[model samples]
Target: KFCNETSDEVDRREHPNKHFICSFADCKATFSKLWKLEAHYSRHTGLKPFACGDCEKSFCTRYQLTRHHLSHSGEKPYLCSVSGCSDAFSTPGSLRNHAAHVHHQKENSYVCNHQGCGKEFRKKKQLKFHICEHTNELPFECDFEGCNDKFASSKALKRHWKMHKGYPCDEEYCNFKGKTWSEYQKHKKTAHRVTLPCDQCKKMFHNAWFLQKHKQSVHSGERRMFKCIREGCEKSYTTNFNLQNHILVFHEGKHDFACPFAGCGKAFAMEESLKRHFVVHKPQKTKLQVNLCDGCSMCFLIHYILEMLL
Candidate 1:
């Protein structure tokens, strides 16, 4: 009675030898062949039939699939394991190529012996190209009679020959002597006098550097040098560099270091610089408001005799 019950259970679970059920829940999808079942499962799961074991990427094509697996296995079966070369590959064909082209260093490998040229190639076709430099053998000649320069390749010759014909030059002071009209136009616009006019005044310089310097010196009214006597503050500098150094050394602080000065909520590179800057916040009697230009003004906490130069 126990054997009959076991047989009935097996019959209920098993398919008719050909039919296969989908693994997904509630969906009673069946296939006659195992391959059909796999294909059907792929549609539901978006699974790739072929996979590369090396990089762990999957592909549909067998060739890509095979290549992908090689990356993971480090199985460059093809290799050029010659002396002086530690290169490894996943395939035999690639290895054989490395040995023949790079490592083997064949006897018949012709090279260009030109003074400045150092090109070595295995094929004679490449060697022929190298020989052209020494012989000055211009197979391609420019059509322009005055511009009789020859080139190794017909394409280069064509480009050079185009230079002989007149082209449009757009530069303010540049002469139109380019091989093509478009090149002349580009040179005129880019290399010539295309510039940004300053919004402030009539004074103009070639670039923005002169303009920035003019703003800093002419517009910045007072040069307030706040020098601190803290142990870290060494040579006084123009900008924040000296101040940052002071904080780092005396205060044991970093560039992003916390301010060790009690009740100060600022982080500084140097402690001395921070202390010197904090002095400005304290109540002081002698304060001077120096006006540089009509548009610029700065406040200083020190006073000196203003000498009228004009």
Candidate 2:
């Protein structure tokens, strides 16, 4: 006899003993438990009884409040295992999805079936998107007045809208621009708020940060180790300046820095390295190894830069 026009026909079930339902206007959501009904009704009243311990934000559901706390703690539970890829995620499914798409290592790739096109993609979502490209369909467009900027995806359109809201630095002779609100705030804080004078170069900077970069890159005793970007190459260097020189001279077939010794046709990446080899054929200097904390190398690097400033 349950033959109502709008009721769920086949998959509907009635709760006999527990009969809790939302009393909110125009909301027909029903729940078997009182707590479930309370949670559903809270959305209509804009009532957020669950408050986060670390932040002022509140949520209607306890689960949402729990999830919001993770952001304040800076916890990324999922991590990528591929070499040279440090991308992290908040969930395991996201980590797996990124690995499959970015690394091209996923099994059973989804292939497109559009006539004579046999290109394969890692995900079903990607295959659907590739099909749309052949159809010449750009569904996402800017909402700005009289603008006709169309994009293939929603994310592209979102980043496009930020073009209208870029914050530019107004300091005399400084022509830096920030693309996002967070970036604008940081630029203002670091570039104009606090004046930090470099101890080595004696150059005045807005924030205390540029001082450490000036010291490490320009005057620090510790040298960085740069590795070859060519796949399967096992070569490394004391500095990127020398490493880039190596790529250009040896790999790219350039002979800019030749050995000055007569009858010695050997070439090198940097002129200084060539001079050192001309003196005596010695092994390259070892890189300065430091024990860094796992999963937070950047945090340590920023701390090191700040220490150098002092």
Candidate 3:
């Protein structure tokens, strides 16, 4: 049977009592339990009985309703037990998947066969996303109003949606923000490792694009070709893009970008400025040096250890 044809024909033939088939037309989804079959049937019948109290959203299953409740609570009950890693998720499935894909490594079965690029992935979806980079294929397009942006993957599209919705960096103490999802990712990279350095001035940048832009404006003495045409405005920029940004920020006075955090209605003219302002709202981490080693004078930087001990 095809992948989409979810009928367990072989299993049904061997043990008919063990398989529960869907009575819905053309959808022969086989389930082991009665409750599972009922839940699956809800999708066919368009019945969503489990409605969320906080929102108008409804789910076909109780498990989905329980998972959706975490969003309102902002609670991450499932935590990774892996040492030196601090990752949390709202659902047990997400936590399990994270542990399998991140903490544990397996032989990558799916390999990108693109020329000069043989990137391997544990999942076929990952390999498909990687292949898009080589092919320059952006199948996932942003459906946000007035936006024509496209992404290679659903992950990229989701992140791009966060940019439109004014989501800030969740990293503690990091105020870096970007106008685009790729820029936000590039900024996040600097938190873990040293960023790329300019060859001339040795000034570090998050990526090559910033490094090249620095070289053009600072080292190459690229003239401010784009001057503000607005009366009484003497502002100039190396690119027309920057000039337009200045106009939008200063003359237009558009501060539609609001803080994404609940109960915080703070707005900013630029996303970068809003990101910088967001750092103050993050829960401050209490850093402490703990002597983990009894044998030697070795100390380790631990966060929230004092709070936990108290």
Candidate 4:
């Protein structure tokens, strides 16, 4: 018997593999068991019943609190078994990530096959997400009504759902909001004007991760070229994002962005093209009433008005 439906017991009997849905607002997450649903609901409620005795940190789950205790105790139970390399981590997940990046460089690395883009990822799932950037393929579609949002990964889609129901900043007179708990923490850091500067170019970024990404993309000698696949089109772009825009405009004819001004409903595939089109609707500046001085060949607005006044 389910709380949300009168005939849920009958429905469950017919569909034995039916999942329990999370009751959190705008969250479409489903779990196999009722206990899993209850555990997931804590994320939206921001409830942390498990508190650490050593510090003021709290976690929604007991397992998470147990993991945090390892950091304070300086205990590294998870160790790398690779020959001649000794590294340990508090969590098994950390150990796995390190093993993938460090130990499995040649055999287990997932390399991208796209021309000019040879980015390697630790996991095949990460490689799949990176391929979407090159192909402009968005497979994860949001089920929210009136929203046609799509993402390359399920994680991105989950983060986007939080924007509809995630908690806002508790600071007074501030309307800052985030789509995830990590994003909220990032906002707090940025609100205080905390910045990370690049060592090579000295460009300031909002966070360390962004700064690292900037360094890898700009400073690193890695360049990618995406070309149009359409017949008779010899166009190539520096990025896949730009190549996607070219395809939408020239081949697919996906003119989604429309001019907001009334009576001139011209649409464009790219937002930049629509922005450039806005200049066509701009009001012409009024020309200044000026008279050319016969003596010095100088133009003066006051000279024309002063002659009429005289």
Best by TM-score: 4
User: How many pairs collide in each candidate, listed in order?
Assistant: 18, 1, 0, 0
TM-score of 3: 0.29
lDDT by residue (1-310, candidate 1, tens digit) is 4465553345445545645667786445666765667666654444465644322234544655666566534366654546666777776666666777876544467778878877888777777866887898868876665666777776576567566655645335657576666666566556774354445555554434344444444455744343555765455533334443654566664655455557877766633345455544553732443322322222222332111110
RMSD of each: 27.7, 19.1, 26.8, 26.8
In the range 4-120, model 4's lDDT, one tens digit per residue, is 664545555555675686555555466676556656766555456567765434466677788878865658988888888798888888788898798763446899999999998
lDDT at residue 109 of model 3 (Cα atoms): 83
lDDT of 1 at 49: 57
For candidate 3, write residues 38-131 as lDDT tens digits: 6876654445667776543457678788887876565898888889889788887888789888978344589788888877787988888888
Cα lDDT tens digits for candidate 2, 1-310: 6676333332235434446656555544666665676677564443567766543345767767766666545478788999999888766677888988999767678998889899999788788778877887889989888889887788678789888757677677878888886787678677777666776666675533345455654577664556888887777765444456667777887666777667778877554456556534333442322233342221222345334433
- Whole-model lDDT for model 1 versus the true structure? 0.54
Per-residue error at 149 for model 4, in Å? 7.8
In model 3, where do residues sit more than 4 Å from their true spots? 1-11, 14-18, 25-27, 32-36, 53-56, 80-87, 92-119, 123-310
Order of models, best TM-score first: 4, 2, 3, 1
Prediction 1 TM-score vs. true: 0.26
